[model samples]
Target: MPRDTPYLQVADEIRARVLAGEWAVGDKLPSRARFAEEYGVGQSVAQRAMERLIIEGILEGRAGSGTYVRKARERRRMIRSRIHREGGGSPFRSALKDQGSAGTWECNSRARIPATEDIAARLAIEPGDFCVMTHYEFLADGQPAQLATSWEPMAITGGTDVLLPEMGPRGKIGVVARMRSIGVEISTAIEMPRPARATREQANFLGISVGDLVTQLERIYFDSEGRPVETADIIVPDIRWEIAYEIEVDDSRF
Candidate 1:
């Protein structure tokens, strides 16, 4: 195994102290100068270790205030499932409703933008094909909770009011209902999620530090004909939320 760096070793020691209850939650920690002297490392190394802990949600740095052991916050569960909704609505909103919280989103749409290679692969379109793209900032109880960037081929929704996801007669409806309205039935939605590090922009939006852990969830909707209709990258912050999948098991076979 590769040897750990000095700063990481220092961080491990600090984390061990914290875990051993030497520093309780919300307890202010010593200054970096003190830590540097105590650990026999450079002050910069101590700073980096503290920053790493901050990014890991173990410590919190307040502006002009000393770093402190982070207070534990309750992480809410974000459920993804084949929820059967009778009418049209975003599944995200439905999910928040289930939790007794009001979920709202701010969205901006761009039409006729060329699909990037990644998006094209998800949509089964050639790169540079025109598509409609929308970026969503989802809020739960007025706090930014999730983010998504959705793409749809213009060939599928061109010239329709629904071209913009959050506009027209049936706006804010989910891909399944929206596609059904346009004569295309969305048959399946497949999602793949992996751990990711937050970018500067995502960190700012989600009120987390850069390099904080997040979940990059890529979901694509397929029509009954097996043609891709829409694709989106759903960003969920790991510090504040946990992902859950609801599986409805049928016992008739048993």
Candidate 2:
């Protein structure tokens, strides 16, 4: 076993007390100074212990409000697969279907936004080139569940029926269908997932604490001609979600 540090030891005791019902849901926890006094450790050690519990979803810190025990909710499962259902819908919708939960979302879009250096690289466009940007806040059972920002090159959808992702006559249809309408057959989507700490704004949007862990996916879609069509950054809170993947196996190996 790794050497137990002061913070972990302190955290273990606090977690035990919480599990033993020393504090009920919504109960305000002792201040860091009080915890240090009781644990006979430095205040920093006590703070670290509380932070550990916060990250574990046991405790939450609110500005101008004391830390309190958080209510427990089942972490929703979000599954990614090689196939999207025949028509259109987001992966969040697919995940909600598995949980028997209703999913809805709010989307706001802007056209002719300059592609940033990062987005430009992902979309094979030069920085400062124009793109249509869409921001999405997906909800499960009416609570915020995920956040996504997508960028599509205007050079591809300019003056087309699919100019705005969720607005035109055939809008709200997914990227594949929208792109297909413009004669771009989506052939591949690549996603790279990495662990991240939530920012203040992100924490506020997802109802999580700043510094709480999350999964960030850098995703891009390419057409049959191997040209990039769209790129997006997807954010999912780790405490509220369990991310999984369904891989399709080739039958020829047998």
Candidate 3:
């Protein structure tokens, strides 16, 4: 390695040690002084090399404790898109007409259950109100890509045409369209972004490591008067999807 590139070389060596299973998870690394002695370098040089790996999210340093390897990094990304709805009457089932090749939605029905305190707060319902849960798994290119669960008020959607297979829009159709069909005008949408590790259930569904990191998107939709219409939680694996946002500025005042 070149003289000025020693830190990177040291980092590469440590990474190899990790991949080769020489240093396992939770294993403490050699002290900085020991590493410097082993590599025939100053303590400052070894410390710098360790710092580089830490910044890359490969190593973690605990305050007052020695540095150690972090849990392996997982590859995941998120893509969030927003759309605005117009007009009064409900959109046709043919709104599916434009998205091409009708997307398939797998559905299952179960008994009403009480919402957690957080869920109840978000849905604006009683703390223990029972809810009808609808889960939809979306697939594209014949691969499982997204999973979503929607919660609806048991009393409102309990006996309507809302449960029909053809009720929503096309391509992972959201709850907003379904509400519109039933005269519920959704005027606001809230989406929460978070990084999470895949649960065993998610790992099996997405065909990834159990510890892999994934994106969790929780959303709440509201009617025009601000009553909660629906709430949904979606899990997206990192290997396949990403979230992008754009900012536009008008330079007229500049």
Best by lDDT: 1
Instruction: List residue ranges in candidate 2 displaced over 4 A.
Output: 1-16, 20-72
Pairs clashing within candidate 2? none
Residue by residue across 1-254, what tens digits does model 1's lDDT show?
23268877888899889989999998999999999999999999999889878866789999999899997557899999886767528899888898999999999999989999999999999999999999999999999999999999999999776788888887888778777788888888899999999999999899776677899999999998899999999999998999999877789966
Model 2: C-alpha RMSD to truth? Answer: 5.7
Candidates sorted on TM-score, descending: 1, 2, 3
Model 2: per-residue Cα lDDT over 1-254, one tens digit each: 23267877888898889889999999999899999999899999999889878867788999998899998656767887767776436566766776798888999999999999989999999999999999999899898888999999999999898999988787776788889888999999899999998999898888766677899988899999999999999999998898888877879986
Number of the top candidate by TM-score? 1
Write the residue-wise lDDT of candidate 3 on 1-254 in tens digits: 13256766677777778778887777778888988888888888789888866754578898999998888654333334344335312221123223342334576655477877888988888887988777777665455667778787776666776754234332234566666667888887778879988888887777654556778889887899989877878888776667553234569967
Model 1, residue 207: C-alpha shift (Å) = 1.1
Off by over 4 Å in 3: 1-79, 84-103, 164-173, 245-254
Cα misplacement distance, residue 41 of candidate 3 (Å): 35
Clashes of 3: 6
Candidates sorted on lDDT, descending: 1, 2, 3
Quote the positional error of residue 142 for candidate 1 in Å.
1.1
Error of 1 at 202 (Å): 0.7
